[model samples]
Target chain A: MKLVAVTSCPTGIAHTYMAAEALSEAAKAAGHELEVETQGSAGLDRLDPATIAAADAVIFAADVEVRERDRFDGKPTVVAKVKDGINRPAELIERAVAAAAEAPAASTPAAAVPAAGVSPATKAEEGASWAGRLRGWLMTGVSYMIPFVAAGGILIALAFLIGGPEIASKVNGGTFDGHTYKGVSDLTLILNQFGVAGVMFKIGATSFSMLVPILAGFIAYAMADRPGLVPGVVAGLLASAVGAGFLGGLIGGLLAGAIVLQLVRLDVPRAIAGVMPVVIIPLVSTLVVGFVMLVVVGKPIASATNGMTGWLNGLGDSNKILLGLIVGAMMAFDLGGPVNKVAYTFGLASLSAGNLNIMAAVMAAGMTPPIALALATVVRPKLFNDAERKAGEAAWLLGASFITEGAIPFAAADPVRVIPSMMAGSAVTGALSMAFDATSRAPHGGIWVVGLIGHPLLYLVAILAGIGVSAASVVALKSRRILVPSGDAVAAAAPSSRGVVAA
Target chain B: MSQIITPDLVDLDLPGTDRVAATRALAERLVAAGRVTDLDGFLADVAAREAQMPTGLEGGIGIPHARSAHVSEPSLAFGRCAAGVDFGAEDGPAHLVFLIAAPDGEGAEHMKILASLARRLIHASFKDGLNQAADPAAAATFITQEIAA
Candidate 1:
């Protein structure tokens, strides 16, 4: 038998892992294959969906709520207390095996089944609004696309760093200030003639070219699983062909995924059903999506993209600073969560359309939180706990490197004081970066890519000002208290295990 | 890696009627070894955990533990009670007692060690070996080997 289990305890320390080990040992002794996921204070190692899909039975040995329990919806499952798993593993395994044998084999391959544990689109049952679901789907697409962004973005930055920012402008047939984004022209010629800097820029730009398709493909993948991929990518390429840009890709992806999801639900004859996912679904959905993209929504989206890009490019200095405040607030609002990703995607969209200032503002705002928090800890050491103080020491490097999540521990501990302080600081920095006429071709890489930034000195100055303002505000907020009890000061100064869970 | 437990922290013959006495005896070794900085504060933390629910388990074992600011590191001290201590397990009094101490806040190393030890305690062979060990050194070494495994 192939068995999978999730073990958790209230304290999330000892018993969670003890149950996992006991279950594993008993499963091995009983000649069964078992994989156990331990959810504890150390953090959970979640079982992959592929593993869950392939399992014969599921066991939940949790004294507390099991996270993502719906993933095991259709599997034969045995629920038991956390201690029962440790002391009676053999009995639990016996019961699990019995449960598996009593259940009928699923007719469909587990991976092909939808609407249960498969995708975020199925979360409508949980009472999520349409807007929330839409955001989840869009965030899914953007998240998968970020690696390509970081890789391609940094490589392009490196190209500029080596070849003096003008090196990449050759491939686009224009300079940064007033040129339209014509996609990269003369790719093979550029590669053959341009040497090392040319190779970096061309390779990086080629990766950038895939950004729209990947975004479209994954958004579809998030909605309708594997079957949604082909149609989604096809529509994305069509969007690209029509000059519809990233905005068109987003619309096309939603259309393709929704179309495929409904098409797969068609009840075909048993004889022909086997080919549905591979042949009929892909072929039919792709054809529909392609037709819609070529004829229906393509041109409107392209005009919207061009209009947004033209507006971004034509912004006056005051408007740019205003845009900076909104972007900065979003970056610090969640401190590297969904809202931050949205701001980042906005920058990538502008970058793809050839508006360079938004990305510079984005990077500056993103870099402010950790640096500011680190600075706060130093100015008033009594404001943070020892663990936070240690984290703050590491935050300087993390912030400078543009890893915004380095400040999560602090924000999680004291969100009310930390997040707004960070927002105020980041807003100032973002506005200053834009007002100083700073621009970046790079999507990310904070201080490391200074040489590639337009007016590097002013960019640095903006960052320093933001850090100073944020640190001072955080210290001030912490020192001046309202509803906070006198006990807050004790928690701040307390040494080890004050926050640690007792086992 | 710092040694979480040494032979000096083990007791071959521990005397106590209840879980509190047995736990304190083992904890005293931690204080003597400088693994714990404050005995009364650490004991109060352990008592709080005990009050949450009994730390007793089936198969004659009791683990009284807490994450205390008084603990210098994550440490474990062992005792073999001559007369079993009642640890609230339905099975009966516990003969093998372990006092687990973790430094306050999120320290990783000792918790991993202690959690791994908790897993190993389920095996009859491992538990029996500890019960049959000839000396304190043998008992501590047996635990270290089982943890390493």
Candidate 2:
């Protein structure tokens, strides 16, 4: 079978080529003809009309949205991330082939291919292991949750930076029922302030508050698709209201997803099943999840959350640093995988309780991997390829925004070296942030909200120091095994590609 | 470009311990095929490109390609390293090697051919066909047919 593929990434460098290369290799090895067009920084290497016409299927492996996607409208297409293409090219190819074979013959050509809006989840999950499916769902949640966190956190931090330390109380002086602005000793009351700072503060806070619910909603959407959204969001809001925090959001999302999944599988009448997703499933699941959260598990979860926050607040400086180290390691472990989510969730869980130090540490650690990788590439240019070096240039902005996903390509390429280096750096940053008592008013925003951080200079220093450690470690680790063969002048002149050279 | 690679350029068993040696050996074949004008200059360019990123890929295939002033035309030389050549890929060394050389300033054609070769290399069966081919002529025919697809 003939197959055509397009590979792209936001950076449009490493992963794009990597995925293209992987797909091409896999297709050839499988004895199927394949052609890959790379949409990269260097620009489009478009698929020839002949190849496209002859192709039985199309594969889209991209992080950023693909341009001209409509070209494949009538073709059997397998859509996935560039990472998936690189890691599981054979599998993606197989799915594309199968999808092409399964296209219904009775329907119109346009209708025979799945609708434009159809998600790739079902098709991609056809042969996926349970663990793989779960990972996919969680990753989808995290990917969706990032935009909200980054935007909200940055805006909130801007508010604090512009409006000063007493901004929250100044903006909402009379409306607070009982929430105290911790560390604000001045207590400046600017009732109904409509200044620029005041407006910024209010808007930022509003966005910041939606963080948990959005996370839950999207997580459920990932699990059971659209039907799980309403219930998951309602459960998340309840979790926030009852002080269950991120953990509650996770539980709520999972519960909503599971409920929706089961509800959709029920042996209902044809007419009922048609309306199930849009009407019955959503309404029933929302009501059920909300009822369970409020009546059954709400109080216990809230108290548990409160207890945890209380314990964290009571920790001594050394213990806080230790906790910071652990959290930092977790954040760098999988580069936005489940382990990183645990650290991020812990930070968000404590956020509502005014324990900003943990959040500060978590964000700092989260920012380390990308920043360190970028720095490593800069310090030792030959250690990485042209695409990687280009990607590193983009990592700076991504890291500053606290997008841990920026380090994914590097980690995906060489996890053993990259992950360990990142972890060490993140741990150092997390521990130092806690030890110094540097705090951020926002959960994310990285260096963009630097002005809002308590002891901003110290925080910056801690982050830089971590980057240094990680960069140095990565360079050292990489260069250690790189051996150039003697007697080959050309080999001696050229940079060694593999660190481990066979004798 | 379909005829750029030939049986004369296909070596069933090439000896090389690493990328530099392997690339040099393949570059030599392109010179013998009258595809390269200056063997040393072309080989140097290939080495420089390889240094930028090891062409060693998943499934043990190495595509060391470069556009150089030393090239007379676009060409492809195939090499099968029995002992494997280290191209620095995290996975492992490469057993199937393709040295692609194109005239300087003609990047489009070079990239097209490389892309084409990359797609074919992805299939296990295609790689197996090349690996199990009895002679250089058979391997060249297999590659030519695959690329034509």
Query: Which number leads on DockQ?
Result: 1
How would you encode candidate 1's per-residue C-alpha lDDT over A1-503 as one tens digit per residue?
A: 89999999765556777789899999999999999998876666779877877788899999889997876776779999988898789999999999989877633332324423444321112134454445445555655565555555556667765765555556555434344334345666665666677788777777667767876887786567677789888887887677555656777898988998787667789989988877998999999999998888766645654654455445534488888877877688766544566667677777767778878888898888888988888888877655567667767765775656556546644557788888889899888988998988776657766766898899989889888888888888988853344333223231211111101
Error of 2 at A378 (Å): 10
List model 2 lDDT by residue over A360-456, tens digit each. Answer: 8998999888889888889898876544566677677667767676675466435567789889999999999988888877665677667658888
DockQ of all candidate complexes: 0.27, 0.07
Segments of candidate 2 deviating more than 4 angstroms: A1-114, A117-125, A165-169, A172-194, A269-275, A295-297, A309-427, A433-459, A466-503, B1-149
True-contact fraction for model 1? 0.38
RMSD of each: 14.8, 19.1
Error of 1 at A69 (Å): 6.7
Q: How much RMSD separates candidate 2 from the native structure?
A: 19.1
Quote model 2's TM-score: 0.41
Docking class of 2: incorrect
Instruction: Write candidate 2's Cα lDDT for B1-149 as tens digits.
Output: 44767898998888867788888888888888788988888888878776765666777878787768888766788999889988776688889988877676634544555455545666677889998999988988898788778
